[model samples]
Target: MAPDYTLDRNDELLIAVSLFEYSREWEIAEPWNAERAWFLCRVICERHGLSPSEAVLELE
Candidate 1:
């Protein structure tokens, strides 16, 4: 289940950015680099109908 396109792009981008920042900060603060990280971020973006393309996916 995911959100529809009813929401504005700005709103979606904000959510995407928040999740992206949190992911980066957490990954930096801690040391956990696995596929799970990408999965979680993907879930977050999908739930909010925010495209992950806006996120800097550098989880390696």
Candidate 2:
């Protein structure tokens, strides 16, 4: 089930910025875009209470 939650704008922005920085650091350290993408997708899904597939759809 999808989450009933909606992050405030501030929280959303913070998560986005943190994810950006984490993604950059992960790429620099490991250069694994595919793995990073999946990891990020999972994190986003978990945070928002969506399944990975659902999260991907909503993201698109």
Candidate 3:
């Protein structure tokens, strides 16, 4: 079973930034996907109660 809740693009960027900055382990790799990053960011924030970035998402 996976965790609940979904994340928008802004949310995803937040996670990518977090992982890239904090988790050096993930940064070694070159070029990361925004979608994957968003998923990670969402999970991390959800677990740590870290709110997503105020940045809004413009869905296409």
lDDT of 3: 0.51
The superposed Cα distance between candidate 3 and the true structure at residue 39, in angstroms, equals 0.7
State TM-scores per candidate: 0.39, 0.40, 0.35
Cα misplacement distance, residue 57 of candidate 3 (Å)? 19
> Candidate 3, residue 23: CA error in Å?
15
Candidate 2 local Cα displacement, residue 53, angstroms: 28
- Top candidate on TM-score is 2
lDDT of 2: 0.58
Candidate 1 regions with alpha-carbon error over 4 angstroms: 1-6, 28-60
Better of 2 and 3 by TM-score: 2
The TM-score obtained by model 2 is 0.40
Which ranges of candidate 2 are over 4 A from the true structure?
1-5, 30-60
The lDDT per prediction is 0.57, 0.58, 0.51
Give the C-alpha miss distance for residue 11 in model 1, angstroms.
0.5
Ranking by TM-score: 2, 1, 3
Point out the higher-scoring one by lDDT: 1 or 2: 2
